[model samples]
Target: MIDMLVNLYELPDSSELYQRLEEQGIILRRANAYERHIVADWVGAHFSPKWVSEVKVAFSRQPITCFIATREKEVLGFACIETTAKGFYGPTGVGEDARGTGIGKALLFRSMEALKDNGYVYGVIGGVGPREFYQKTIGAIEIPNSDPGIYRDILPD
Candidate 1:
């Protein structure tokens, strides 16, 4: 998987995405310190152990680098920034039941927006999975020869 780059200075507005998710009973907000363990466990169970580890670091950071999609107090999905790698956006997912509601798109744009607000002129979607999604959503471009760019030492499972 190659890394992809996003132009933080040219990101689309985020408030509109927030409003759209809110209308669907989805509350999009930063994960609070008190919710760290719960969120990390959820991510681990639903995603990967590596992602869980990165998410823990995100929670420890001041301002909380993780964002979550919740409905009625239950975690529906999550996205994290500046975790696993600096100036990077990733490790995000929606529950199987939560798919097809635009939740993923909202998470992607909103998290990249947070990176922009934090003074990043450009953000790396490190080791991208959905190439067309990134391309259509934010015009993310391939970082040539970035395969295993930062995960050159990833240990075998």
Candidate 2:
């Protein structure tokens, strides 16, 4: 006889899960205008200040949502959502201290679920990390980038 043990985790609803995030020193609230500016500055140090500014403006103009992970109310991680005529997805980041904890996956799943719920028929994500995760979890595929600098699709067949 062989014995196997599988541990199952239950994901809470948005409100309850958010409470848990609070308890864990994390917060999944929408990023405000100024905070977006701050994020732009911080991330710009490595990426691009122009790109950061673009994202901040984009968030304001569209349904760009963010779920931020925090500790002591300080940002630890964040997932960005951009919803357009095309689809919805993330350019998510997990802090050095928050990686390897399934936070990114959760953020990805949440984004996809929201997209699906909003009646999106397909999703094409830019970049790589979430693309790979989508491939494994939702049967996403890497398609040729229609435009330069973009590459991957997580849409249903």
Candidate 3:
């Protein structure tokens, strides 16, 4: 898993994607402090304990760097920015059942936009899983020699 870089200033407009999600009754918004436990638990169940730890960190920020996709009170997906490090976007996942609903992309855009709002010129996508997806969606470029970057000395679960 290599890290990728994205130019935040060049992010594509996400309004159309957001509008489509809205029509499907999906709501995208920043996760509130009060929802930390719920979101953390969801990430643990749907992704990994490592990601749950990162989600907790996201909740600790003043503005809560986490964004969630929900529908009628059910969480469909989530994205966390600046959790592992400043200007980092990651730890995002969509439920298996919600995979094709555009929730993941919406959550991604929300996270990237937030990074931009925080004065970031470029953002890092750490330990990317879907390399092609990032490349096509946000024009993310591979960072040479970045495999295992910050994850080099990670402790085992």
Per-residue alpha-carbon lDDT of candidate 2 for residues 1-117, written as tens digits (9 for 90 to 100): 111111112222445444555566555555676677666555555443444544565467445465556566566556555522245354566666677655665565566555555
Model 2 poorest 10 in a row by lDDT: 1-10
Worst 10 residues of 3 by lDDT: 105-114
What TM-score quantifies how close candidate 2 is to the native fold? Answer: 0.62
> Residue 4 CA error for candidate 1 (Å)?
0.4
lDDT of 3 by residue, 133-155 (tens): 99999999999999988888888
Q: What is the lDDT of candidate 1?
A: 0.91
Kindly list the per-residue Cα lDDT of model 1 for residues 70-124, writing each as its tens digit.
9999999999999888899988999999999889999998898889889999999
- lDDT, candidates in the order shown: 0.91, 0.52, 0.93
Between prediction 2 and prediction 3, the one with superior TM-score is 3
Which is the better candidate, 1 or 3, if ranked by lDDT?
3
Model 3 residue runs over 4 Å out of place are none
Candidate 2 deviant stretches above 4 angstroms? 1-23, 45-51, 62-64, 83-85, 129-131, 144-157
TM-score of 1: 0.96
